[model samples]
Target: MTASSYPVLPDERLAAGVARLAVRHQGRYSVETVQRLIADSYEQLAANAHVRTHLVVLAERFAAERLDALAHIESPTGGERPRVLFVCSHNAGRSQMAAALLAHRAGDDVIVSSAGTHPSGAVDPHVVQALTEAGVALDEVYPKPLTDEIVQAADIVITMGCGDACPVVPGHRYLDWPVPDPDGAPIAVVRSIRDALDARITALLDTLPGA
Candidate 1:
């Protein structure tokens, strides 16, 4: 079917089921394009609570039916490693902390990235300071959008404060840790967040195969 005639799914389920339809029709579109279309259509069905409630199923289908084939599109020619994405409301606090701490502790065992639901362009100064104090040296960290490639590449997606804005892709492990925001907070509080994130990172490392 042409893009103009692309049927909008009724809700998440229908949106999710599009791949099955495509499979049945042996559609001309590539799986990547079809998955992108499905995601866009589902996001438009923003009215129903069932769509939100059924997100896990939708994500699962999206991953299995669509994402799995395209999951490592960003990796190197020889294939790299499993990635982890950390997301927060601003990408300036919790996500940055978690990502930095994980990278520091895990020592490149996993590829780690962080993003925002609504990015603020720069990492928070306090977050940088806290991480520096904790010896993480976050000189390269910057706020970025939560993209499809990032989500697909990540084996685990951790959301600290993005709430409902974080994308749910199927077949990936997702966690929402209700950590407090450290923007404009005092150094002590920032340090506390740093410590907390380090703890979480340690736990995450333990779950990894070679940790």
Candidate 2:
């Protein structure tokens, strides 16, 4: 089959995302570099038969996540704090909210991360709005696939609705929050989920080693 079946088109959304990531890169690299990275990231998942659409949006997040990881691989905060990994059915809603809330509340006290057992094309719009309304910045995050390394690196792993999809790693602290998946849910429902997560995060913070 020819590559024509899988064309990489740079539309307005993709360009806008590239621009945002370029700014986030702090001029360390040119916009061209960031855009290329995003294109490459998109191609990484485009081959997956399961990923039918949303290639542009997923590329933006995957590229940003990869770049952010590269930016901090050698930083001093790499392993200084407790690392928490939030896993959900799709890393778009509950887990995203949890990480955002914890990161906001705990700041540098916790290294917060999130992923999906079955990754989604994008984050839930309602969840984004709820967190944005609650004052948690969601621009820097995108849904990502859960990997063994991320799970192993985390001091704590909280599962939302992933059930058996979430891996069980030895010596890794685990908690399963019975929070509803807010995908396609109404705004009020998303807000309730966000509030519940905020409370749970508050309690979780109290149990951390340094909290």
Candidate 3:
């Protein structure tokens, strides 16, 4: 699609984000493609957003992730690291904690992503605090909706509490963790959930190829 046919973003900040992402993905995706994804990402997040202060930046990050997943799905390279996706009812609590914990433990041994069946406006504050106390860096973490490209790209899809909501794709390994949701829970409860996820992640890491 041509640039003229692309929908204009209401926020100039989002337009700028589109430009940055277009340049970052230059040669891989057309500006039009980047613009479309950014616009769609912004719309998706805005629909549930309670605070608009960081929406533009979060939209850019979300679009970047989708673009990367699309690239992985379109072009498969041998020896690429395993990709793990965590899913839950809301990306705010369980899934976010799982993804962060796995990423921290696995480092570059695995590629980690998380999404929600029904994404919330932000990551739950208690979730963030729990992760922070564990020394997991969550500066860029935010709740995002599950997307087709991401699901298709994952080598393993782990569901926390999303049940049948997470899409099923043939040949991708799927596991369901019956972990409790941390939303509205106190810090102590959130910490316990974090530790439970961490233990699961440690066991999961051992099963990966390199482990």
Candidate 4:
């Protein structure tokens, strides 16, 4: 019934991460809240992960994003930048590329996040290679499942081939970009998809409030 209701096996490994997050969000949330989110994030990511080497670090990063989203949703600040969420089926290719491309071009002008309806274990290699070729840093990027907090914090929800699985939040601008999936595609095709997403992001940025 609640986020805390999700089963989280106790792991001492997450203690350091929880402490860091608590201090980072000092006034905004309690230590228990950070611990709960970190545990939940670890569980969600570990569920379908193929490699567990960096799972703990990734979990910490994921939890931090969720906390930031939750903070934004709870507090209403004037002149806040528009938030955009990109969603695809696996979050391995299309959504990841779109989010990275948008963030690269948008800079600090917009808040960008991406997730999958059904997240894969890792990001597509081709997706990483293509973004790398385009000079966008893909460090710390990983496939993440959709969550209510992130969706609720978005000003625009862009769906790329995720179809009806993407959540529909009232008052948020929803756009469906029918882009081709680059799951198993070669580097060339992936690069083309990246360029296409870049073009789309360009157009979307122009329509944003401060643009």
**Per-candidate RMSD vs. true structure?**
10.8, 6.6, 1.4, 3.1
Model 2, range 1-211, lDDT digits (tens) per residue?
A: 3434333545546777887898999757566667767776666555442543666776787777666655554243633678888999878899999999999999878878898887776678888899999988765566777755466667789998888788898887999999988988999999999999999999999999764
The lDDT per prediction is: 0.67, 0.78, 0.89, 0.90
Tell me how far the alpha carbon of residue 61 in candidate 1 is from the true structure, in angstroms, after superposition.
Answer: 31
Candidate 3 CA-lDDT value: 0.89
Global CA lDDT of candidate 4, please?
0.90
Name model 2 segments beyond 4 Å from true.
Answer: 1-79
| TM-score list, all predictions | 0.63, 0.68, 0.95, 0.93
After the best TM-score superposition of candidate 2, give how far the Cα of residue 24 lies from its true spot, in angstroms. 16
At residue 64, give the lDDT of candidate 2: 77
Please report how far candidate 2 places residue 132 from its true position, in Å. 1.0
Higher TM-score: candidate 1 or 2? 2
- The numbered model that scores best in TM-score is 3
**What are the runs in model 3 whose C-alpha is more than 4 Å off?**
none
lDDT of 1: 0.67
| True-vs-predicted CA distance for residue 32, candidate 3, Å | 0.7
Error at 98, model 3, angstroms: 0.5
Position 185, candidate 4: lDDT: 89
**Which of the predicted structures, 1 or 3, would earn the higher lDDT when compared with the native?**
3
